[model samples]
Target: MNLRRLKYFVKIVDLGSLTQASEILHIAQPALSQQLMILESEFRHQLLVRTKRGVTPTEAGNTLYRHAQIILRQLEQARSDMDKSSDTLAGKVSVGLAPGTAASALSLPLLKTVRARHPGILLYLNESFGTTLSELIINGRMDMAVLYGDHASRGLSFQLLLTEELFLVTPRGMPMPDGPVALATLQNVDLMLPRPYNYLRKYIDDALAIARVQPRVVAEIESAATLAAAIHEGIGATILPDSAARIIAASGDGVQRRIVAPMIEAPLSLCVSDHLPLSEPAVAVYQILLELIADLALGSQPPEAACAAGARPQCPEQLP
Candidate 1:
């Protein structure tokens, strides 16, 4: 019933050992045990099951743990917000970005914007695969993450940033269609893409399956930069979002075409764990990224204008 006692109980569940939690909390073991017993008595339920291995939470304990995480996170956020200056905000924010998302689009712009605007805040960016980034966010290792789906996981809340169309990227000057390319046309094309489990790869595979088109996959890759470089080197072609293909094409070695006949658009989404409150600094970065995306959208020209010159999203080598 006591918040402080409940806080300690959550730590015990997290660390899986009361003794370890006691050491971290600087509370004597007997005192910690006494408070836990009192808490259990107040709740009138067996919150934890203890064995020689360690402690695990009961169903009721798990419920309390979830609520307690949100409570504590909110408490911390409130303290941070109060301590921040009216003119400037300062704190550490940890954000995870899926590999292709960061290298191709978000990372540099995010970093530059944060530096120019919230100079006092320290931003920690972790780049990993989508599933790994999702895990990091759900486990509280990262505050928020950018993902590529319209739907969110059980405990995550997602904001749709924009709908991004995927393009077929090839070596420069590769002959392609004059207009939108058919999805079935990729059947004979050699592909360099991320592994099957990757978000983009899975989407492409599913699309291909639906179209009854079996692509010739040459390599299973992880990094977007590598995927682009491989295609530019004539190793294979790849399917990429317009922004990513824009960055690659801007380098002057890649040519891209918009996929058609049931166009595939990977939704750019922002995901935050619903089980925890966002920190003040994380909130600032979130707003900034949203603003940047909005600015890019507003700056977009007409299709003819975009195509006459390559009008890639913000990167602008322009692939219509």
Candidate 2:
């Protein structure tokens, strides 16, 4: 009935012995036994079966275990929500981002908005691959993240922000075909591909396979800056998000962009866990992100211009 009793019951089931559970729970065995008895009494069912080896969960106990896990999670989330509300928007928000393009294209804007709007909130940024970011979010190590590739978790929800086409960037003077180059064209060319372990690399490889083309990879680099530098030196052409390639093209006088024909595009996702209840600050941050995204979709108009047209200020000049 109580969270403590439920926790003790789950612990007993996990340890399979009252002595072991009590040792882990740091309670006397008699007290732990009493707690279990109270839980069974409240449920009006025999929760565990005693055997010479140890205690095993009865059918009723198994059912309660499942429900107890959810209940405990909910209770913890509620407490977290209360704590967050009491403190207002004054806690650290850690965000994980995929390396290279997504970090530049998505994380930068979101961070800028946060800095301007929530100056009191501390921001921690980490760059990793999409799969790593997802695991961190699931484990409660990150509050939210922007990731790429497939999102197949039922417990996780995503909002597709944009679809970015992949492009092959080369030096300005290099001879490029007039049309998009097929993957077969890359067979002999030095290619700077993402690491094979990366989700983006897998997606790109799958796309290449669909076209029945094999590329000759010269190097695999993780950092966007390193990849950009490699491309700058004309070491090899790298496949990158169009936005990223465009940024590099604009900055590097010698770099030229060629839109890869039979384009490979990947969805950029804003992912959050459905099982975790968001704090008021987190909810506010999410809403702000949606508003900022809407503004971006509306040509990224300046706040003054948006306000003049009776549209809500996407990045208001006020802070709480």
Candidate 3:
């Protein structure tokens, strides 16, 4: 079957009229009709029934339409891939990132690395909660993502990047809680928690449930900076990855962070769809991420250590 004929058929069904389809496809009406006729002849079935208002698909047409959608999508992806390969280290990359620390701690570094190594590559970043990021990656809306949680999708392959412990953050000068405060301690404490649907929230809730503690949440916030500000204002304490908590504590006035007792740790995972192959630029960025993460884990140093070690920092924090 001719792909062009299939394209014509799909356009006809979409517009519901040959005249409209021809106008949209920029083909002569007679040519469009001829293509549709050829498609119907190849299928040996009536694909559309004519009505006074417009054309409607027959049962056979509907079946073929579904397959045509898939075929067209694959064709488009192939074209995009081909175009991408024509230029080395130059293409568009869309990445989904988990909210909070993963976005700042992981995705930001990877983005900078990509920009430096492949100046021609355009980077698009989206921040989402864990499940949403997973769905985006699987659907091809995102080329890659940094996620925190269990790898639940069989269609995705994950690499274990690092394990980060959770920390309890509070305003500076606040009396430190007794050693290893129980999850119940959060009850009646002003608490800034992630939305219930967030993967980090799920991890926090699971840990609380395991400890048989119920936390009285004061508010649900999304951004790490917002949550840190809330903590600094003494609105409530929040539990977050130590990397983020420490960063926030270092910057925020009078804010302190402590590791959560009993050590609720989550594995920071880099996820990619098994169906997609990484581009050369993306592969280079991923390798840099591996090296950066290894450096962080080996010495628990901030990413700025790269700068200290003779590499210029791609992102520099403004000194307060």
Candidate 4:
């Protein structure tokens, strides 16, 4: 069926009057009626039932109308997408990063890349706890996120990035306890963790629970800088991915120790809403962000080792 005809039919069904539809369409009532006749003849079915008040779609017509609406919508979307694809990628892309993800390393590099490669594209980077970011993405406020594993499945699609080791961060002067800290030892530590509502907190809480450790959370702070500062100021020790803790340790503010005894490696994922059809800019951002995460996993500066070596922030360029 012609898209033009489908549009006309849907409008007629919506207004419930051919005269009104003709007025809206700026077409003669007789011409509209003739088109309707041709459509009914082509289908060999009476599509609309006429009555004193107006016209209503028959069962077959209603079905066709529903399908027509979808078809018309798809065609409109196709046109919109084609218009976007015709030029250099240019649109606003919003990406969410949890406090524990190393957003600094990726944010600038991503902006730079978009500026250089797709000058029209603007990158909006949002930093929040995984729980908050997940909510934003699910509700369509944000487009995508980098999140910890346990938070992946609530109506969101996930692409596994890496399973990076977790670390116990202590004050700068605290003696590095030789090597990997056994996870069981965390039972006695006073932890300064993110709030209970944070996905990172949930992930740590569940793992510690399985280890049968009764965590002593001395404080809760959502900002990574503040969290690291707390540990540096000796407020309390806390757990974080080596990637997250690396910069803090390099700044000589905190010390990081790998967690062992059924190694605490939190799986990181690139997350997006399962229901939303990704736009061109969103897809570009996703691929670029994914590459950055992949670099973290396979790069020469292994997070656990990098922090110990006093390496600077692991930007994409610095990675092997």
Candidate 5:
């Protein structure tokens, strides 16, 4: 397949008009149309349907567009890796940290270590929802991500980092078990939780379903501040990973207790693309992250305590 034709098709689809794409690409309208025709002939499918106002991608065109985006990005990454100076490892590396998970705490350390050790590298950090981050990796927009779940995803590779024990957090002074709270104990407890799609929520729901326990869900909240505020206002209790629960409990908004009887644990994984290899700068950052994890022993302690014990600079802010 001609790479130039793929580029032309993508631009045409993006602008929704061949004429607009020709103008932007500095190609004559007829030349651009010929390229599109060649692409269609190669695929043996009508890639686009001409409408009165503009062009719309057919199903085949949409599939091709998705693939072309990944291909183009990978090519650009290859060029960037080749252009880097041999003396200094330098380039942009994008990493995503899923919100509300233990991995979110690594953002600061990752940034600091990269700057000190590999000053030439530019680190781009994304704190977004787990699913969105995974999608970005698959699309070649992000290099890697540290997020919850080891579930198999197409075009993605996973490395088990650590498992976070879930805790039931209640408003301060609320009556709760001294040791571990059982899933059945939350049957009548009003719960505030993230939406069902959230990885944390899915883990909690799966465990509850297995235990045949149904807790009354009062609201769905994705924001950490809002959830903490709601808990302080006595709206409802919530479940969270140990790191996050400890932070909220430490802040005096809630009291956290380990969940038991059927303990729920969220598995954290290092997610990268199976098809796209990491660039030099990305690999350097990856190694630093693993070293940080080992040094801080984040698996065994709350992030704050781990940071304190490791004598590392505190994170600038808590990731949502």
Candidate 6:
């Protein structure tokens, strides 16, 4: 298969419009259609189903699209590797950190370290929901991400970085137990939690069910700022990882109490694509991130010293 034709096909499928694809690709519409026809003929399958709205990929086209993305991404990495000098690494590296998790604390350090070590590398940090980050990583749009999910997820390689225990964060003026709070005690307390689909939420739900405690959830918040504001305003207490709660704790707007009698914890994993190889710049950043995580003593933190470290509240809005 011709690489150029494959590239054109991928673009057309992405845009879902031949005319739009032609405009972006700087090729005539007729020429683009001819190229598409050639590709379909080469594969001996009708790749797209065209309608007045736009084009939709057929099963064969979808398969081709996935393979093409991998091929093109690998080709770009090959070019980058070949172009980079032995002494200097230079390119764009995108890393995603799930909000409202321990990984959020590493963002600033990762950026600073990347700049100090690889001056030529342009670092792109995405503080987003876990599922969105996972999709981007799998699609080759993102280089890597640290988020929570099943380690068994297909099409991704996982490294278990750390598992941070969840803590109950209560707003100021709200009275709570002195030390560790049990899950049963939160039944009467109004809660601000993520939607049911979130992994963190699910963990909380499972813990609650096991403890036979029913919670009074007031709102479902996904944004870090909104969640923090709500907490400061005394809207409702929320459960989050120690790192996440540390953000609220540092603000003096909320107090962190470790959840007990069935503690809740979210596992943080360093995720990368199984099909796509990391570019030179990405590898450099990846190594820096691993080193930074190691230095933070993330998973090894003692229960009594959980809130000893301070962090900025970048609570995850949505973690699919």
Return the top candidate by lDDT.
6
Candidate 4 segments exceeding 4 Å error: 1-85, 173-176, 300-320
How many Å off is the CA of 228 in candidate 5?
A: 1.9
For candidate 5, write residues 83-158 as lDDT tens digits.
8887778788899988776667778878878999899888999999888998888877788898888886898887
Best model number under TM-score: 6
> For model 2, how does the per-residue alpha-carbon lDDT over 1-320 read when each residue is reduced to its tens digit?
47889889878887899989988889999988898888888989999999998999999998887677657655654665566544456455666667654333445666777778776566778777877888766655566776675465865666676566677777665667765777667767687887887767887887778777788888998776777677677788777776566655554433544445456877666677757656555666676656654564455644422211112222323222
Candidate ranking under TM-score, highest first, comes to 6, 5, 1, 3, 4, 2
Give one digit per residue, the lDDT tens place, for model 3 in 121-155. 77888887778878766655566776786565766
lDDT of 6 by residue, 137-212 (tens): 8778789998876574788887776677888999987988699998999989999988897778888899999999
Instruction: Give candidate 1's error at residue 236 in angstroms.
Output: 1.3
Candidate 6 ranges beyond 4 A from true positions: 51-53, 173-178, 249-252, 298-320
Per-candidate TM-score against the hidden true structure: 0.67, 0.64, 0.66, 0.65, 0.80, 0.83
The full ranking of all candidates by lDDT, starting with the best, is 6, 5, 1, 4, 3, 2
lDDT of prediction 1: 0.73
Local distance difference test, each candidate: 0.73, 0.67, 0.68, 0.71, 0.81, 0.82
Local accuracy of candidate 1 as per-residue lDDT tens digits, 136-199: 6775657887767757778777777656678887887566777788989888888878777777
Of the two candidates 1 and 2, the one with more favorable TM-score, higher being better, is 1
Clashes of each: 4, 0, 2, 0, 0, 4
lDDT of 4 by residue, 1-320 (tens): 66788789989999999999999999999999999988888888889999888899999898778667656644554554676757677666788876556443566666666677777666789877777777767655577887776445766877665666677888866655778887788777778887787666777887888888898888887776677667767777878777677765655377778787756666666778777666676677777776655554555433332322222222232211
lDDT of 6 at 268: 74
